[model samples]
Target chain A: MKRRRPFLLFTLLAFGYAFLYVPIISLIVYSFNVSRLVTVWGGFSTRWYGELLHNDQILSAAWLSLRIATMNATLSVILGTLAAITLVRFGKFRGRTLFSTMVSAPLVMPDVILGLASLLLFVTMEHLIGWPAGRGITTITLAHITFSAAFVTVVVQSRLSQFDISLEEAAMDLGARPWKVFLLITLPIIAPSLLAGWLLAFTLSLDDLVIASFVAGPGATTLPMVVYSSVRLGVSPQINALATLIVATVTLCILLAGWLMHRQETLRRRAPVIDIS
Target chain B: MTTRATINGSARNAGEWLGDLLTGHHGRRLVIALPYLWLLVFFMLPFVIVLKISLAEVLLGRPPYSPLWQYLEDSTVQIQLHLDNYRRLWEDPLYFIAYLKSLKIAGISTLVCLLLGYPMAYAIARTRDSLRNLLLMLVILPFWTSFLIRVYAWIGILKSNGLLNNLLLALGVIDHPLALLHTDFAVYLGIVYSYLPFMVLPLYATLSRMDLTLLEAAADLGCRPWKAFLRVTLPLSLPGIIAGCMLVFIPAVGEFVIPDLLGGPDSLMIGKVLWTEFFSNRDWPAASAVAVVMLVLLVVPLALFQRAQEKSEGKPPL
Candidate 1:
């Protein structure tokens, strides 16, 4: 493969990554610009960072977003784990096709359609059943769960399918109850993936704008909604500050996850060799 | 003694059967029913409602639509059907134009992502295992950040006095700061930048799994590198190319963020149109009609493609 000219390959990777990172790096740098003008940088200052802290609307929205995301992630995990287990554990059951189809439906569905459809559902259900009397945080969270559950299901299901089931069988053979087998043997083994799925859902919910906008009422502004409305006016250094903070936090988390994953990989490799010996 | 043993065996069989009844396929099926039922109630039912609303009259009311039924008695009801929403959608040139423009933009963006992502995915796929892991991680790590933030970052780069224009001005590429911010070009850039990862990951999946021996054989037979690539690599990686394109194109068609933020008012994507009609015009039925029409335009071809792919791959139809 190296016999083919490798120069072009290196150039493409360089340009591609430069395209991806330069915009982000510039955004971070401009966050500290002293001047109010975003395009030109005066000397470095933390004015925007200070401003961001004092902005109560953004702060409250961020808090609400965090609360909703936490709840959404938790619900998504529980529901997603259930769906994954069903698809993996149940064999040729009734409505299997519909279950699988619905599980993956939201992955590619347009947000406009999804949001519209769900909003319509809430409206009719509100009028007919008098449950969820209005769309707000509850409706938003449920709507978030509807799509994020699909994401969680995809993640957990893949991990579940790859899982070894003989351990559960062995536990069952030893007179463990069915629920006990699931509790002790299955859940623990897939816990890491469930964590990953939860994190994915959390990020997705936190970042969402379009779907949330559709379902959210006046009082239910999320962080993204606040940022979006602000951006519509003009780019602000405060938003840059927020973006920089988000990028840093995400980068740190990913690095930590990568390191942990690498360590686990090495441990698994070593343990297998020890067993063979 | 034989009769006593036989009786004991039969008794144990009955106990096992009862245990199976309590903790068997039937019980597991009920456990499975929970999420399935949740989706049936929430996900599928909403589409039904959307469909219902699309066929109803938009009115100023609590729910903002006329109900399909008027109860005259316990068993008698009147059914009212409205086709004006559909008819209006058919007559409106704006809706049709938005659909065409969306397809064009999405198609071009998919092409651009392919052009950029192919080489990157190829390079990563061809790298050694350790390097490949790191490269793949780098490609994916940015996605963990807020998508809105990522798109926002582009404003600083694409604005008149922003990074790209300033750099070009400094280099004397052009005398004036170009109108790079609010145009089809910016929209293209936004879509390509946002969706490049979607393209690369799928392509990498396919490319890495490719049997390199075929390429080696072609090389040994004195085939030129580019020809070998076309004959061997391209054909083998068609699945990835298709997957990546569909992933980018389908979502791009209904994309609201990029066009709303980056593209000018005339951008006219169906998503933006639907939103304006609902929020500004307060036309629930019209918006619903637009959504229904958009779903048809997007879903039907994809459904056909999915069925074809599943058949070819020998997977379960679902």
Candidate 2:
């Protein structure tokens, strides 16, 4: 009975994993399926991928999404890192609790509400400054930055809790200026966490549909927006192809990151042994 | 000696004090506080604006916002004034019903996730160390993909004449495709699939932390496996269950994408309604009101959940 129990557990675990990923698996498989219906099996072909490459609208939207994601991520990391350092290190003051809550509010706040608020902000800005006259890439990018930075702040702050301040103190004692210490020691130590936060922010900005849809004007159509409008009409194989590409790229990047981390750990262990020698 | 005396002047001490003020022990706090201020300006202030706008009357096609902004400039804007939007919300039964329906849907999906996630999490937790990491990785790998794409994949599966229907037809289960898409059932499935990982991680955290001897002790006391689970295991794991539910339910209530994509016309969740009011309808005032209400609904529960979590963590409930 105990032996049989292991087998049952294995089967259950396998089923659960399959349940989690089968839809995604099927989508990737069907992207290469020549058949139009996603359900049916057809001979393998890459025609959809070919079609995706040739589609101008899809390509442009993808470009726009990438651009916005990069900008949003960069801005988010800068702001978030600063905020994280302050909140975790400084700890308490007047309105500190309120400030912490405000920073994180965007993380849980409904996307629709965020979109409206951003739109309202834009309108108010337009009325006051007579700039950013309409919803465009700039507005969308700014909106993305708003929420993405908040998320990045949380990630960086959490990571900061694990950081040792002793290294910076040592650097300062060794005749480095405070800024120099931060740049050389603190930044390098926290770089991986910052990178992770940046990646998360980038992915979030790229994948945003609802907010982008709200703030996007004619020229600012992001990939998600394009995919959404297309999906609303009906399922298209092109979307399947696009999604497949994204999933593949993301999966590869994640695996690469993991491998790099593993290799770094291995090298670190080897370095200690070499030093002992 | 004279040069040294000049260099050690009081002005240098004053400058040092100013520099200390700028870069003190709390400098990091001041640096981090900048983002919080930005959030207060951009994120929290909008809610305040929403509250203010919700009070103003809708005149002609334009919203009554300018006057309210002016009223804010003056001392005449009574903070305690507006109950009309709240009153209207109460008078309209549909709004309340929509909130209830959303809660029910979110609740059921959260429950489903918990049921499915617990066993999976347990299996992963109990696995041999070598394989455990791989199993956990597999569980989290899907999360790296775009959530929207994952949800979109289900559309292909659930649509009439879709793969699931075709597979069933091929198996001679049914002659016709079932109306699976555009239904509350589909929305629930989507929610469960999306939120399952959230449920899994928390359960895994709690279960992994557990000492196996407690279960063994229950067994020694003549408790059966099921009884052991009910008595010892369940109580120990309630923290995880609560955490998982909060993680799933909080976001699920505000979910827009799944319902917007998979739900039918009748399945008008507040998220979709809110989206329309803000974007398509361009009724910012009404949209703000709805948003404010949603925020209120969420914040109260969120506070309660956090309080519970804090208590479990052995802290005074804030």
Instruction: Give the best candidate by lDDT.
Output: 1
In model 1, how many backbone clashes occur? 0
lDDT of 2 by residue, A39-126 (tens): 6778899999999999999999999999999999998998888777766766566876566656655665678878877777776667
Q: DockQ values for all predictions? A: 0.43, 0.38
Candidate 1 regions with alpha-carbon error over 4 angstroms: A1-5, A165-181, A272-277, B1-23, B73-75, B217-224, B304-318
Q: Give lDDT tens digits, candidate 1, residues B40-117.
A: 988999988888888889899767788887888778989888989989878988889898999999999999899999
Which parts of model 2 are misplaced by more than 4 Å?
A: A1-12, A129-133, A164-181, A272-277, B1-26, B59-66, B69-88, B209-237, B305-318
* Per-model CA lDDT versus the true structure: 0.83, 0.77
**Per-residue lDDT of A1-277 in model 1, one digit per residue for the tens?**
5665489887999898888887788889999999888889899999999999999999999999999999999999998988877777676777777777687667767788888888888888888899787888998899999899987886787678777778777777777767556666777668777878998899989999988888887779999999999998999999999999988988887788778767867886776431110
TM-score of chain A of each: 0.91, 0.91
Worst 10 residues of 2 chain B by lDDT: B309-318
